[model samples]
Target: MSAFTMAASAVGVKVTTTAKRASAKRATAKASSSAFSARKASLNGVSLAAFAAPSVAASKSSQIRALRSAVFAAAKADRSKADDPDAGKGQRVMIIGGDGYCGWATALHLSNRGYEVCIVDNLCRRGMDDSLGFNSLTPIRGIHERVRKWKEVSGKDIELFIGDVCDYEFLSATFKKFEPTAAVHFGEQRSAPYSMMDRTKAVFTQTNNVMGNINLMYAIKEFAPDCHLIKLGTMGEYGTPNIDIEEGYLTVEHNGRTDTLPYPKQGNSFYHLSKCHDSTNMIFCTKAWQMRTTDLNQGVVYGVATEETMMDPALINRLDYDAVFGTALNRFCIQAAVGHPMTVYGKGGQTRGFLDIRDTVRCIQIACDNPADKGEMRIYNQFTEQFSVNELAALITEAGKKIGLDPQVINVPNPRTEMEEHYYNAKNSKLQDLGLEPHLMSDALMDSLLKIIIEYKDRVDKSLILPGVNWTESASVGQQLEKAEKVKA
Candidate 1:
């Protein structure tokens, strides 16, 4: 007997030899005719009571028909539940750029909270790290492996779609398939220094960021019109306006007129300018198409581990400490780990809002829970506290000493053209009013970061710590242009 036949026989399935095949085929034909009638009846919504009635003969075929009808009804009910917006399953959220830092953590956070989460990413952030010849200080797993590990640890599944949001075909197809109730957009070039590297990079940053956002707006309008769009904007979009920074809009009192308008934007870098463009496009889409959107103008997110990321080694998120992608606090913590001087640019008086990564994920959840009204564009300043560069370096120094490390702080020439000191208060009451409890930066948190960095000190590259890209230089022209061309190609 063939192996297949032997296996079938072991499982109580009749395995006929050539001699008995003809008889088996005849019997199967009769059974198939009966099975087809049962399936047809089930699909037509025939009453199961008829099958269960004592007046009807309870043959083997009758039992099969009843079972089929019951299974079909149950499956139909499940589909209805999944499709209903009022159903709990309607909490489906599609996270664009869900493989990156904030994206990855938010994906897991929502998944842990019983939201049906799906991640859409092109893995361009990982490609950028490859181009820069550096990796996250803490090793990160591949996107496929990361999601797999999350499933293993949490017993929850987060769907993954590998595609760029700029590709409308792919993005629209995924949107249709997922049918998300809320879409969280983190799919854009996020680094200011990287955007300022050269002409090609600057152009690429704006094109990628702006085009992807436009595509997303249309995709939501076309496929999932009711889908709430939660876009991750930057605090840098406002720059250092002399006046107090409101959440997203500022009221103006002009000559004999008063109206609310979008806050004046003074974006500092090409990347921040791209964000400004995205905000404008999002606002336009909301008004033009009656689409709901929540633009989160978030601050500098610090720390690596969230409750979900720490569950498994493969689930760990990326930690960037290079000048190109690292934030001030992260760089200081890593610099102290490798016994390198914490390089504070100029007088280090440039202040900006900051938040913990844990809070970052929580804020996203709050936005998802409380969606904006139709035709409304809501903006929330997403940060817990404000800290200057000097304050961050000092905190790192204090934390380092407690762990028996002598962390030295030094001032370096400022690479960017900006004020060293300025007024920096920004309102962040919207999320707090919506029940978002913030996590303040503390010595304990800093100490935990130091300990983690010490464990991964072997992976730190001291050479990439300091600022390299100068904002004063013009766009690349000669050999730099050629290199940029190759990268573009």
Candidate 2:
């Protein structure tokens, strides 16, 4: 203070020690004000000079406080924008394999929520029905017809692209043309029994699921690096572990060391193995290329109708009750409706996760609304509830009795090799935490399924309802040789 006073005296301004100290404080405040002005300009696009310039007569403390408040407000606004899923309205979403069960409903749901939706499918799921000599228990229209009907009913258009995801050229072209904000991939061979049928089918399943996913990753990298990849993985990838299943990873402490690693995978079939491969590749893409991905390890999806799928008869979704494609609950309800015994495999103790088709579409929307961060590979176990085969049969039996129908339960040899009885608990809190309200299984849902089945009862192929593909049997020698020759060629 004495030095400040001496300097002031030399400058021809007489000042007391207190006056000198006060003068120095004013200069420091002025400097801080200038710095804050610059920071405020940079923090948000607004310049304090244009709107809330500090008055010359204002106290230094008040000025500083005002500037700090403005900066904090701006930063908070930015975070709110980033986290709001509503910010994604009117953005584009490309649904690969949108003609299929989960994809179809999700496409409509997103479109209804104000998204521009387009579907990319090769009509292979329909082709599979032809090749198998069976059709869905409920008749479904062609993709073109379905989309047209959707437009008529909802007054919203969904663009259709007819091509296979395995074809890179087609996939790349679709990506370039659409330039999607997100891509929901349901383009995979999804049947475990079908994949286990023979060598040819197994090879095709691996090639289609694994190669198609790889192609999608590369296409997204090239065309839309920022696009979120929402892939439909399977709970079958985890199989039936003795311990409770974690979402996608596990933290381990081994030999006095600890690290978090991917949960150990024990896929039960070739189809499930293909899903495991997809998960590995997805993790690599995120780490190497800073790509964003969300792998939904989904449970067995039940029910046939979502809000969108029920809008019109032409917009009806497929109800598969065949052993190859149908789920346990769906098959049970159909069996109950048709006066056939509910087939429970191996003591009816095999348990797995389950969810409604309505929940399936909603989960997809939730994933899209809350995308993963860049270089982040998010994993969610997408299911609402868990039930054993025996439990499903029992529930259906009760529902069937209330509707004046006789339902019987019969235990058959398990076709697939798995734990007949074991501990089954999986964490499904992530989806619910992200605002997913699930539709739990109930008698009303079962009754609705029975009514639909009764309407289309004649379409049910009783012959296809029984298990055919046995996991214990190996592929024929001719089939293996043929596959080998094809590989050589």
Q: Candidate 2 residues 1-489, lDDT tens each?
A: 343243223333323333342234334334534554566566444434434555565665755677667656654553344233233343578999999889998888777655668999998999998988978887789899999988777666789999999999999999877778789999898999889888888899999999999999999888878788999998989988888899999999999999998998999999999999999999999999998799999999988888778888888888888888888788888888888998998888888999999889878876776677779999999999999999999888888898899999888988889889989999998876544667899899988888888899988889988877788774965976787799999
**lDDT, candidate 2, at 201:** 84
Model 1 Cα lDDT, one tens digit per residue, 1-489: 242233223323332332242233334334533554565566445545656577866775866777656655654443333222222223678999999999999998777655678999999999999988878999999999999988777666789999998889999899878877789999999999999988889999999999999999999889877778999999999999888999999999999899999999899999999999999998988999998799999999998889889988898888999999998888889888888899999999999999999989888876776677779999999999999999998888888999999999999999998999999899998876554566789899888888988999899888889877889774765757776789999
All candidates: CA RMSD (Å): 17.7, 18.4
Task: Give the least accurate 10-residue stretch of model 2, judged by summed lDDT.
Answer: 7-16
What is the TM-score (0 to 1) of candidate 1? 0.80
Provide the clashing-pair count of each candidate structure: 0, 0
Clashing pairs in 1: none
Please list the C-alpha lDDT of all candidates, in the order they appear.
0.82, 0.81
